[model samples]
Target: MGLRRLAAGLLGAVTATVALAGCTADGRESACDSAGGIVECSPDQRSAAPKITGELLPGGTYDVANQRGQVVVVNFWGSWCAPCRAEADDLENTYQATRASGVTFLGINVQDSRDKAIAFEEGRVSYPSIFDPGSRLALAMDIPPNTIPATVVLDREGRIATVIRAAVKQEGLQPIVERIAAESPEPAGQR
Candidate 1:
């Protein structure tokens, strides 16, 4: 059983890397019409993002529940997925842009390793990542193994704002994030 879990983790990591790569296609020429089988963002499909627990690298545990009142962009990815890698830079860039505004990006790297995760974030991506090797979190989110490189955006109050199971472009992410970051709860004194 232990061995099986380890294998699953490794597989998840590889898949995430590939997904990242596919998301990196040139934004100017991105297939806005399609994501090569991946789903594009839309209101009907903008379901609640999944929430799960994970192990922070170098030994720590964290969960999205801790991020209430702040907008969170949670991404499920693997090291071997092309689309995930493709969007790494954009993810990093957008995260940097929104962090100051109270938006945070949480990367849940599945089937991947510490080394690869390190390299991916150190180079261009700049967000804290958690490991989901056993896949309890991935399953909770209903993420198919092949349909990875997925992203879930949380509203300011921590409700899932959207789910994008495609090659995420900055333009696609920018507007939603901006909305979340600027979203404010109604004043308690108001009716």
Candidate 2:
């Protein structure tokens, strides 16, 4: 009877531990739901994205926080990455289609020289890209872009709504951007 009692206690403890693993320290659900390489979070489940401010390749500064009222699509890329090159046009197309709806696209060029990165962008994309040879900005994200051609979509409230950890095509990415863009912005006073 003592052996049976111990076994029951151990099983209960294991179950509780597994359940708690999915919760944050403050008892909120931890991390976004991920499926087939795409990670998504509901508005209430989203956490604020890390501050992203940097120098643009051509010349200018950008602060993601300043784009609160717009849905922002951030892409992490490198001039030498084949996948990044392959997805460039698709990203530009999606950006053009969604920009009228208050959607903005920003790229972070990682591990590439300014001249090379600029050449890669010439005529490929209209949106501005930040010059980040060391990938500091990418590393700062809550869900860091572990891959060279990752994309993160932020809601109007500046919270991370979706993360795609691979090259994205226009057909696959446009719907996600449009869905997030459709969400109503928070009241000015609430921000």
Any runs in candidate 2 off by more than 4 Å, and if so which? 1-30, 186-191
TM-score of each: 0.67, 0.82
124: Cα error in model 1, Å: 2.5
For residue 10, model 2's alpha carbon misses the true position, in angstroms, by: 29
User: On residues 7-61, what C-alpha lDDT tens digit does candidate 1 reach at each position?
Assistant: 9999999987855444432341133224444333332223344566667865688
RMSD value for candidate 2: 7.8
Task: Give each model's whole-structure lDDT.
Answer: 0.67, 0.87
lDDT of 2 at 179: 93
Q: Which stretches of candidate 1 lie over 4 Å from their true place?
A: 1-51, 142-146, 186-191
- Model 1 scores a TM of 0.67
**TM-score of candidate 2 against the unseen true structure:** 0.82
